[model samples]
Target: MPDLEDLYREIILDHYRNPRNRGELDTPPAVRAEGFNPLCGDEVIIYVRLANGVVDDIKFGGQGCSISQASSSMMSAIVKGRTTDELHRLNRAFKSMMSIEPDPDDPAPVNGNGADIKLGDLEALKGVVKFPVRIKCATLSWHTLIQAVEEAQTTG
Candidate 1:
């Protein structure tokens, strides 16, 4: 069996090479947000459409390191058709998995027990916690996603 690291590397490369939910939404019925990592010049733009408090669709566009790009791609795939509440939970779980400190003011419940969070393919990014510099790379898209969601909530 391949080691966990090797498997994660393969998953990350696959997403980077063939990103899912890439590109932009054609019309204005969507919310968009961008995130940039000045240190690495990595940028990501997230486009989200919410319907009835659920993510109707999501896509991303930008250029960045393999980690950032892949994480965005994976995020897009996981978020589609999920409710805003679900996104909050998943976002908190993803951030925790990356060992990022939760914002005290944020209402998302992040109970540190990984076993309670069902990350699925997003788990491939857990390795990022070991590399402090790359953690930002992996999380840039997530921050952008949250912004997009907030934008959607406010507008509609």
Candidate 2:
């Protein structure tokens, strides 16, 4: 059997190879946000459409390393149909997962509300924290998603 790390690596590679929600949405109805990481030259563009405070649709486009692209792909799949509050909680949970030191006894991390957030395939990215610089690569799309949602709130 493959080790957990090997499974995670395969998951990341699968997303990178066949990204989900890989495209663009029309702007008048969708809020677009772009994030660039100069350290690694990973760029991600996120388009989000909100309806009744829910993510009506979401898509992503960009070019970067496997981590960034895979992360954006995973994020797009996870965020669609989620409410803005849920998205925020997920963002917090993902970011927290990226930053927190791993504890052998504590495998799961909670969001601000102290509730366990099931990360799904996103759990594949937990290993990214081992490389400090790659954490930004993993989170670029998430930050852009937050920006797009905030923009939608201000303008819509």
Candidate 3:
């Protein structure tokens, strides 16, 4: 039987190898944003299509380490069809998971919103907190998603 760490590693690697929603969306209907991590030279571009205050579709393009690419792929998979409110909750939860002071024993930490948002496959990224510098890599797509969402709101 694989240990929890091994399972998580496999999940991450799977997403990295076969990324989900890996492509682009037309900009007129989709808002695009890009995030870059200078320390590791990881770049992520997110294209989000919002309709009726919900994410109708999403896609990603980038080149980076496994962590960044997998994180982007996982995020793209989860965020599509989610409302902006749910996206915010997910962001808070994910960021909390990546926080430096997270309780080591707690597998699911509550976000500032006081909601224990289920991270689903995203839980695989919790181990990233152990490596401080890599947190940015894991979060690059999320930041880009935020920007895309903001632009989507304004231009949508």
Best candidate according to lDDT? 1
- Candidate 3 regions exceeding 4 Å error are 100-115
Whichever of 1 and 2 has more TM-score, that candidate is: 1
Per-model C-alpha RMSD: 1.5, 5.1, 4.9
Off by over 4 Å in 1: none
Better candidate by lDDT, 1 or 3: 1
Expressed as tens digits, the lDDT of each residue in 25-129 for candidate 2 is: 999799999999999899999999999999999999989999999999999999899988788777778877887433233223343533388878898998999
- Clashing residue pairs in candidate 2 are none
On TM-score, the leading prediction is 1
Model 3: lDDT of residue 122: 91
Clashes of each: 0, 0, 0
Order by lDDT, highest first: 1, 3, 2
TM-scores of the candidates in the order shown: 0.94, 0.90, 0.90
Q: What is the lDDT of residue 24 in candidate 1?
A: 96
Model 1 TM-score (2 dp): 0.94
**Deviation from native of the Cα of residue 66 in model 3, angstroms:** 0.2
Provide the overall lDDT of each model, using Cα atoms, as 2-decimal numbers. Answer: 0.88, 0.87, 0.87
